[model samples]
Target: MGESEQKVAKEPTEETAEVTGATVATEVSALPAEAPAVLPKTPPKGSKSYELIFLVDAALPKEELDALIAKVQGIIEQREGIVENVRVSDVRRLAYEIKKRTHGVYVVVNFFLLPSQIAELERLLRLDERVLRHMVICTRSS
Candidate 1:
């Protein structure tokens, strides 16, 4: 040991992890770098959330129902959202007679939709007088 001897030590203040891209710094006894944080969990587009169910009038003929369903499917597709499932319950009976027909067709569809697009769908259904009654229900969230 003499005047020519020298020692080097790391000062521990705060060091950030470059890999994580975060402003927060971490303390370590050695290199003292924070561990890279993993990406926040995000629900996939096909998540079971955003469950939506809409009931269409059964008064319209089978062809009309098919057409409307196709159009609606297109709209939903354009939104880039996945359709989990669709159920159509066209019960051949109505609370009252419709168009002098004692039996009315009932249709039920379940699909996901954006909040903004809901208004547009409602408008479309309203334009069609053939629908006796319609109901829209959201079952889940994403």
Candidate 2:
């Protein structure tokens, strides 16, 4: 082919550029540059304090209850959480029956754990048959 014909063949036309997305790229490049987005700082992992309260069968012997509490503490420590305090209250009557039990022992634990690990901890608690009911709350604001 002649030099002019070769040039015409090699140069991309508007339809070819549009079909190949080259026109979109060029249009994007022609726009003004934008400043980088500023994201808010997040609290450090494992810095938040949380409170875990769980109820167990009131009929359980003291030794078994103690062991159960220790097991829960172990679960928290396994996830790199620090257990600050553990309070086991005397048997209390439940407002409503849970698992056909009207009485339960309430155990409260204060600990520091990563927010991401909270869901896993809850799942573990829910799966424990010994635990009649459980709830975790953030003890301190992030």
Candidate 3:
């Protein structure tokens, strides 16, 4: 063949197998044309239960604290979530001072919301100055 002319070989089918000095032929079909379907890794898009715990500056007055909690609740409500229960603890000393304060108010909240809305809720909490720390946990059904 010329330098510009290249040889192209076709793929071997299952019917043929090459031996050291002979050729053998059999009959079988090629590999499957498509892969099997796979299910989604997460549950379907819908309301899932969650728990939220947050710490706020202890020195703030009750009115300020209420407003702060309301802001969080509003975020959840805006995303079509229901705030089931809220528990606020009296000011207590922290293991270490935060934002130059020795005490903080601990708040626990249980709610139901779509999984897609959790990130936005966290972003709002992270941006609030009064909120010192926060954690969100998905609660599995019993």
Candidate 1 regions with alpha-carbon error over 4 angstroms: 1-60, 98-101
Question: lDDT per residue, candidate 3, 3-95, as tens digits?
Answer: 965545445444322111124455443444364766533433578889999998888877788788788888988887888778888779999
- TM per candidate: 0.51, 0.66, 0.66
lDDT of 2 by residue, 20-51 (tens): 12233222222224537667444456469899
The TM-score of candidate 3 is 0.66
Per-residue lDDT of candidate 1, residues 31-128 (tens digit): 22454756744434543334434444554666676676667667666765555555465456656765566765455555666666666767776676
Q: What is the lDDT of candidate 1?
A: 0.56
Those runs of model 2 whose alpha carbons end farther than 4 Å from true positions after fitting are: 1-46
Winning model by lDDT = 3
Colliding pairs, model 3 = none
